[model samples]
Each structure stands twice: as structure tokens, then as C-alpha cells.
Target: MQRRANVELRTAYNAFIESKRMSDPASGLTEIPALNQTLKPHQHDIVTWALRRGRAAVFAGTGLGKSFMQLEWARCVAEATDMPVLILAPLAVAAQTKREGEKFGIEVKHCREQSEVGDASIVVTNYDRLQKFDLEHFAGVVLDESSILKASDGKTRTAIIEAFKDYRFRLACTATPAPNDYMELGNHAEFLGVMTQEEMLAMFFIHDGGETQKWRLKGHAESEFWKWMCSWAVMLRKPSDLGYPNDGYDLPPLAIEQITVGVDHDRAQDTLFVMQAATLQDRIKERRETVEERCRAAVEIIARKPDTPWLVWCNLNSEAELMTKLIADAVEVRGSDKVEDKERKLLGFTDGQIRVMTTKPSVAGFGMNWQHCADMVFVGLNDSYEQLFQAIRRCWRFGQTKPVNVYLVAAETEGAVVANLHRKEADAERMAEQMVAHMQDITVATIRGTSRTKTEYNPSVEMTIPQFLEAA
Candidate 1:
């Protein structure tokens, strides 16, 4: 069989060479490089992560091939257990993951909405679609962009929790797992069933010891808790623990002009915040001018920089709606956009034809690369670090040569969300450092060749350097 295969391959190669000679005499089609070739250091960690059993978390940064890690793990788990794997993600992100799998040459089926999935070992779907199906059939589960579960009442989150209630082989992949607050981590951990939400709050978190119950987080302590908890799971980061060629991406020079919406615009525009539902009406009343002024500014900026492509990230529908009408040539790519159209617009932007593509980061961020536009204009921000990280990384990828610049064109009222972004980035760095310190032990755990319950995390008779995070 080996001799027959070699003869077949050699014949095919010779045929290709003869065919090329018929076309261009000097032409040679060199074999393409492997998609996972020259993987970042953290990428290696991701491979180690999926080899084990139980639940795991590959908390890797953007451009780190996390989807590959997830896919590779799913393949291994399927081979071992012969049970199918289900990957749950957002609708748009599901498409992105499908594309990633194809790019990496992984054969997986994406179940159509409301359709019955077959024996395809790895089945990927959106949260909405996953909610519609029976998840008990899957032996493995991966929650990409896991932070979407931060909102307890979210339809997607609620559906996932209810569906995967009995699921043990869980893995949550995200760079900004807990962006807004530590409470976000509870959902992912709970899905892992490593510790329940109640256990997490009681064990990892503590209230600010002040008179009031203001929440003050304990950062690395909780990180350490995850480290001990995620022996089966692994959290990896980039540019440090995973040394990818950060400077390899040749980005175009970015020149951003900061445009701040001042409070002196009008009575309504001046007032940007509302404390409650009672004030929600007042918030709208106050936003009338502010919203109008921002629309005018969008026009002004586009008119000023007519040549450069502008990406306006508006949070409120009012802002986005107005801009869509005012800017005649502009295209707004939102969550509600058709998958093909959204993909077309993104491809257009990357291919250097489309100039301006206005969108909310929640819609355009994650697994979509618009490296053509090195200059990003943030029209608004939400309480999500995952979106921000994915949004910024769209420009700061491997092909970008120039310095990627993010222009924060925000109204002062959106301070809390902006603060949250900075906090999350800094928090991720510290988590990255803590992870690097224990790299060897984590690597050993992955190759341990045995799965254990939390009580018996001891791999005594197994591979070398058997030490837990608690022991370390």
C-alpha cells in the first residue's frame, strides 16, 4: 500500500510539472506552507491543552490561532471517545470559525439553522442555533469568545447554560474572558463545572471591605485559582508567553486626528448619562443633541479625510441609523447583516477597494481581519474587552507594517466602558505573566496522558515533574 501510494503521488507530481512546462517553462508551484507552521509559543501551549480530558480553557489572545487549537483538540477528543463535538459561538463568529477550520484544512460541518446535524464529529453553530438543537449528543464543547456569557440574562448565555448542564468536556476560549468584572469569569468556570458560580464567588472573589458593598476584584489570586482549577484547561497569551512575529505584519502608516464631542453642544447633548430606567427617558431627551452632533461630526470627519477609509463604531442604534442615511456611500455592517454581505464588505475592505465601512465593534470584531485600514476610529465603546481586543487586532495583525492607531472618538459620558477596556488590557498582561511563570508545569500537565477528577489531580505514576499549582 505504501509503494502504491508513493507511485501515485510521484505520478501526480510529474503530471503537474509537465502541465506547468506546457504553460510557463520556468514556472514552479512550490508547496504552500502549513497553516499552523511557525506557531507562536502560546500556540504550542494550546496543542498541549487539548490532549488532556475533562474541561479546559485556552485563554489565548487574538492572532494566536485559538480556533486551530480548539479544532485540534476536538479532533483528538473525537478520536478517543468517538463522540461528536459541538462548538457554540455567535452567528457571525460561527461563520468565522468555519472559515478558520477550512483555512487550516480541517474537515468539519457547520449545521444549518434548525437542521439536524449528522455524524460529523465536530459540529459548529451559533448560540441561537445551538439553543434550537439538542446538545447532549456532543461529547465535547467549545465556547469561542466565551465572554458573551458575562450577561447572565442574555438569550445565548441562558440557552448555553441550560443545554450544556451535564457537559463535562468543556473548553472556553477567549483573550478577554472577564472584561467588565470578575463576575464574568463565573459563567465560564461554571460551564466547565470545575466550580459552580456559587463556589467561584465564595472562593475567588471578595467584596470591598468598605461600609458599602462596592466590588473590588482580587486579580492574580483568581488567576491562580483558575491555574489550579485548569490543570485539564490551559490559559495562553501572545507576544510574551507565545512569541509570534509581532512586527511581521506590514501595516500602512496611520495618522489619526482625535475628535472629542464636548459637553457645550446643547442642553440635551450636554447631558450624556442617566442613572436608571426613570432617567432612561431623560437619557434619550439628553441624547437628542449629542446624537445629532455626533452625526454631524461623522460627516465632517469623512468630508475632511475623504481619501482614507473611515470606520465609525457607534453603540446606539440612533447614531448608526442616522449615519447610514447621511453618508450615502457608506456601508454599515451590523450583527443583523446577512453573512455573505458582511463577509463581502470585510473582504472589500481588506482587498483595498472599499474606503469607508461603518460598523459596531460587536458586529465587525473577532476573526474578521480588515488589515487594510490601519487607522481605526472608535465612535463608541461598550462594556466588553473581547470586542475591543478583536476590533483593534483587526489592524494589528501579521500583515500590518505601520503602527496601528486606535482613535477614541467618544462622548465623555462613556467613561465606565473606556475605563473597563484599560483595566482588562492591564489585567490580561498580569494574567499573562502569571501564566508564563508556570509554563513548564502546565506543559507537563497537558502531556500527562491521564485525566483525573479535581480531588485527585495527582499524576503520581504518570509523566515527569508532577506538581500542581498549589504545590508550585
Candidate 2:
């Protein structure tokens, strides 16, 4: 009788363990046709994995063929469902994506409104134009630079997630999903319907306490969280992270130089001696006070390479105006510019018509591929490390043949800002390493069509009832 009771207990325990395993159900195609032949091995595998998962994200680094993979995914989904797949991208990227589609032999239609999307297998539109179309018509949707979902206003972000909650297929592709904040991972998770943000927090995170917004992973939940992440998303800084060769995907040498302009101590009214900017307001003041010097430094850097293409990123309109005015061949793309004007100038720069382009990182940093230009200058910077990282990547990403040089021009009083940026960058690098370490094996297994095995419960010592209980 005791032996039989032990057997029943072990069975119940195994059943409980199986029920607690974390794996998303595959709502996607079990049998996929041949994908685009142009895909690299890594790209092909990722595309296949995404199609199998139905709703997924590809957090591939910049210049790692995200465009190719996403286009192929869209094409296959469109063909499989016999319905259009809509791709929403940042401003000026729709045209670029359309061109990419053409290169890969996929016909992509660029549309602005619902009527323009008629009968197109793959439709590409800017994020701002999302409301102009009907979401119910498409079988699949792709967010090219899906990080914008977090950067956008709350209402816009919610609208996007709510609109696509029921879509049969979805893909979110971006390089920096969570640059410094892991909490942002919840955005993509929530968007994919893998879990709600609150639910994810409850499962894997604990309140870090002082601030209401702060949360950290629970100590025991790290492995399980990443395991859950691998089920629905794949992240890698390079091909080798997923056990692939890094032959053509290797990036060129990147050189970063800081140019510090002298700040006028007389401009500081609060103290007898000018000190490092300690707060956001002080940093803004320092940047504004030294804009002229910073802009001149940027102008000097670009002047040395006058014949070469230069990408200049600034923060304030004042900096943009000054840099464009000081640099003879510079074209500025401002936030207030008309959409057509922004597209024209951006494409002009891409086509080599403009030798120097001045714009805010928020304006032109997200998705532009500026490999032709190996030099860039940041005349202004905010504390947002993600923006700074993306701005530099515009010129420093893969496929650029020459060594890339980045110049950050800041005033002496703004030392703290630069230091803060460096600190955040270090944090981001550490976080990425941790992410890759935890997800590498799992991602490789998932992409290569292997299943994860849960730990089985085995009874070593024979289970025997207590003497008192047995007697009772």
C-alpha cells in the first residue's frame, strides 16, 4: 500500500512539472515552402523559425540582413495566406524597404492610405500613416524598426498593440530592443501577445523599491525568463551568437574621438567656478551656452574632409540651424519639415547628392543605412544612450569598407553628460553580453529545430510513509 501511494505521488508530481513548463504554442505553418534563395544560412534559419512561431521578433544587430529576412518572411506569409502583408517603418525607411524588396525580387507596394494598398501582396507604409489604413485587411504585419513602438507616445504604442493583437502573423525587427532597460522587453512581449507586460513583470520581476518605475529580475527567475524569451524571440549581436560563421557579417574598425570645446566660465552665474553639469537642466544650459563652440568644432571636423560624405547629428533646433549655416554643403532635415521634403533630403544624402547632412538623431537616426559615409559628428547629445548608439550606427554599421570615424563635440561643462553616456554604454554592453550568454544555446537550438527538455523528477531514495502515519 505504501509503495502504491508513492507511485501515485510521483505521477502527480510529474504532471505538475509538465504543466509548469514554459513554451508558446505554435500557431504558424508546420510545413513551409522554400524561402528566398538569396538568404544567408543564418537569415534563412531565422526566417524559418519566425514563420513557425507565427508571432515573433528578430532582434538582430544593425547590418545583419534584417531587411532581407523580414522581406522574405513577408513574401512567404503573403503567399501562404494569399493575402497582403503590411510592413510599417519609420519615416523615409518605407522607400528604402521598397528598394530592398526590389533587389530581392519581391514586389513591395509603398502606400499612404487604404485605397492605395489594393491588391498588393506586400505593402510598406510609414508609422505615421498607420491610421490611414484598415488593419483588418492584412494577414500579417511587420514593424521594421519596432523599437519605435517604445519610443512613440503611449497612445500610439497602445493603438499599435491593440490593432494587431488578432493578426495571424506578426514580426518586430530591431537592433536595440532593450539598450539599458530590461523592462522595455515587456513591450515586444506584450505586442506579440506572448504575455501582457504586467503578467511578465509578475512572473519574472520584483519591484526594486525606491521608484515606482524600477523593477529587476527575481533571482531565481533569470533562466526561466530567458527560456521564455527564446520561445518567441531571437536576439544576437552577430551571426556567431547563434553558432554561425561571422565571415561577411564582421564590422569594420570603428574609431570614436571626443572633441571638447572650451566653455566660457563667465557664463555660469550659479557658482564662482564653472562645474560639471550635474542635472538635466544644467546639461541643457551648458549645451545651449556652448552651442556655437560645439558647432564650430563640428564644422572644423567636416571641413578637413570636405569632399567626403559626413553625417551630422544634433539635438536642438539651434544646433541644427547653426551647423547647417556654418557648413557650406550641409543640408538640414528638421522635425517640422514636410514629409516629402524629409524623404527627398534623406534620399538625396543616401544617393550621394548631399555631401554633408545635419539633423537630430530623433529625425534621421533610426533606419537609414549610410555606409557610403564613414564619418559622423554629434554636435549635441541628450542622455539617451539608445539614440546616441543608433546615431553612430548610421555610419559605423557593417558593409562600410573604410574605417568609420565618429566625433562627439561637447563643451567642457558638459563632461558629466559624456561620462553618463559612457556609463550607460557600459551597462548596455554588459546587458547584451548577459542576454547573449543566456539565450545563445536556446536560440541555436530553437533555430535549428531542436526542442528544450525539462528536468525530470526522479525519486532516488524509496519513498516510505512515516511510521506514525502508517500506523494511523
Candidate 3:
């Protein structure tokens, strides 16, 4: 009897895992001829990447030419597949997207109803009208300002995701897809069919609190989750992240000034000491009590340069009304305004016809490009850092030649709101840095990763059996 020797053979477990990880699940969509010559180099690259992936999300920052990228993407898909592409935009953004398309010689039909969308190569409509059109008619869909899918009214979000589920090509474009909460990313994941929101939560996250749907990723799953995200999405704050030059995209200097008004403690509180707002109701009470003071302070700042273009952001309808009346040339757009009126006034402001425009960020903040205006005033504060950032960026984005001025007008007691906003801003900045740093190289790799061809294992070395094994 002799001892037997063991022989080892290696399997392609690493190769199989790598291949499956990097493989794109999309139906291979063919690239079309260059649809737009006017696209910046980075814009061209993004469009090309979307074309290859078939379904993707471009989480580009404000003023990074997301509109241009989206338009070109729609154009490419429409041309390549010879099927119409649908673009779902925020209110007034459809018109803006149409204009962006024209610059590149791509014709975009802005539609309010299905009848208005006839025979168009690229159809642009608001998200609210998602149910109006037949989803099967279009081969591709693009969601401009895609974060709107996370709106509290989950109906629209659910409709957009389910409506476009069968479409061969899909794109979700936005500046903030997951602004503060990671759960927001679930909407994108589900919309793109990369993974269902429930599956994503189950795999990467857990119920953070005992009684809330609030999800925090499992500590060990953070890296794996981000890597999974990059397989289907690309988030870049600037072109430089994708190895493109950022020469013309540089933002001008931003000058933010805080204007504090003395609160009449007797009115807001019975005691001598005015306490800071600690809750939403308290903040609302403070805002209601001091709308006049905040607006008046904002009005004074605007009056200094009466001829200059200014954007005033208010949180309450009352604030908008007071500011519009107090400022002789101001126009206010409220939530109750007719759709036509809202579009007209927003376009009017964009065209420089309106010297001063007053509106809540909820009404006009998401998509309009107001680079023509260099001055802005925040008449009050809201808890949403996204709204605050969007409102400021309406003026402070790229293409503004002058330094942008932002005035934050708040009452003394609203210090808590202002401080909270500042804290959120800092947190957002840090999150953005982390997101970019984590995604930049990985994003480049993801794009390049998908194009990789799997290397087949071919061993040139001849293997010999062990003498003991051969004897056996």
C-alpha cells in the first residue's frame, strides 16, 4: 500500500465573478452617427457612454451641460433605433430643453398633450403629463431633473418607473438624485430596472430606526453598494472627473450676505427671551410672524439696484405677495397660478423682460436657467438644502460673467433655520466630495469596465500527474 499524492486544479471563480460584475444587463444598443456637433467634448463622451449602456443615469451638477447631454442622448437613440424618444422634464424645463436641442440642430417637439406630440423625433413633456402619452410609442425615455421622481407624491414616481419599464433605452438626468438621503437612490435604481427598491434595501441596507422606513446601509455593504451603483450610473460634479477639461465650466465667484432682522419677541413669544425654532411648526410660526420684516429687508437690498435683474426666493405665498407688491417692478409666480401664466412669467424672467421675479423655490427652482441675473435674495428659509442650493444656482451657475450676490434675509429668531441650512450645506458639500472621490475613478472604470472583453483562460503549460497518483 502506498500513500496517494493530491493534485490541484484552479477554477475561473475570480474570472466569472469579474465578468458577471462588469457585464451590462442592457440589450446591446448600437451607437448612432454623431447627432450634435455643438456638444462639448465631455458632453459627447457622456452621450456616447449612455448609448453604449442603453439605460443609465447622469447625475451631473448644475451648469455642467446636463440638458445638452440629455438632448443629444435622445437624438442619438431616436436616430439609431428609428423610434421616437420621449423626454420627461420639470415644468418650464421642456421649453428650455427644446431650446437646448435647437442649438445643436436637433428638433425637439414640446408637448403638453399626446396630440401635440405627433411625428416628432424627440418629444419633451413635463413629468405631470407622464400618464397622457402611450409609453410604447417611444423606444427611449429621458428624465430631465430626474430627482423629481422622489417627490413626496409617490404616484408620479411610480408611474414614470412602471411606464418606461419596457422601453429599450432609458436615462435619468438630475443634479441631486440622492441629495441627503440614500433612500432617494432607490427611486433611481427601481426606475432604471437595475434593481427593485426593495431588493436594494434588502441587500445593502436595513431599517435604521426601530419604527421607520429610513434605511442606512449595512456598515460592510457601503463599498459594495457604491460599486453596484457605478455599474449603472455616473455622477460627476464636473467634466474633469471623466478626464475632460473644465475650461468653460468654471463658476464665477459667489458672494453670500446674511441680513438679520430684529424679531419683536412680544409678538412671537410672551416672554422676554425669544427661543430658537426647534420644530417645523415653530419654524412656520416664526416665518409667518416675520414675513413682513424679511421681505422688507429683501426689498431694501433690491431697491439699491432697481434696474438690476434679481431673483427672490420665498417659502410662503404671503411672502411672495408682499414682496411683489412692495417692489414696484416685481412679478410673483405662486403655486395657484395657471400653467400658462407660470410658463410666461418664467420665460419672461429668462428673457430679461422681468427685472425682479418673486417665487417660491417649490414653484420655480428646479430647472430654469437664470444666468442672466447676478443677484438673488432668499426671503425666508426652508428645511430643504436642495431647494436653497437650486435657488442660488439659478443665478450662480456657469455662464454668468459677473460675481453673483445672494442675500439671506431672516429674523433673529429664525437663526436656527439659517444655522440648520448652513449645516446641511456643509454636509452636502462633504457628501458630494465623498461621492465624487469614490465615484470618479470608479466611474471612469465603470464606463471602461463595461467595454472590457473577458480574457479566456488558456494554459500553455503541460501538466504532469504526480508519480504516486499515476501509479494509483
Evaluate model 3: give its lDDT. 0.79
lDDT, candidate 1, at 318 = 77
Candidate 3 per-residue C-alpha lDDT over 24-119 given as tens digits, one digit per residue, 9 for 90 to 100: 365535544755777787777677777887788899888888998888888778878888999988888888888888887889999988888788
In candidate 3 the C-alpha lDDT for residue 344 amounts to: 91
Stretches of candidate 3 off by over 4 Å are: 1-24, 268-270, 416-418, 443-472
Alpha-carbon deviation at 378 in model 2, angstroms: 0.8
Error of 3 at 130 (Å): 2.1
Look at candidate 3 and give me any clashing residue pairs: none
What is the per-residue lDDT of model 2 for residues 1-472, given as tens digits with 9 covering 90 to 100? 8667767777876688677654555567777789888898889999988888788889999999999999999998999999999999999999999999899999999999999987999999999999999888999999999999888999999999999998879999998887457657889988888887897888889997899988888999887777677667888899888888998877889888889898788876788987888888988988888889999888888889879999999999999999889887889999999999999999999999999999998989899898999999999988888999998888778787889998889898888455677788898898788778766776554675633223233447754556775564
Score residue 32 of candidate 3 by CA lDDT.
48
Kindly state the number of residue pairs that clash in model 2: 0
**Higher-scoring candidate on lDDT, 1 or 2:** 2
Off-target runs (Cα >4 Å) in candidate 1 are 1-41, 114-116, 152-156, 209-233, 242-257, 262-288, 303-309, 335-354, 382-390, 411-472
Candidate 1 lDDT tens digits, 233-334 = 455444444333444324346444456566553434345543321344543443554777667766776676677766777777777888878887777777
Off by over 4 Å in 2: 1-23, 268-272, 416-418, 443-445, 448-472
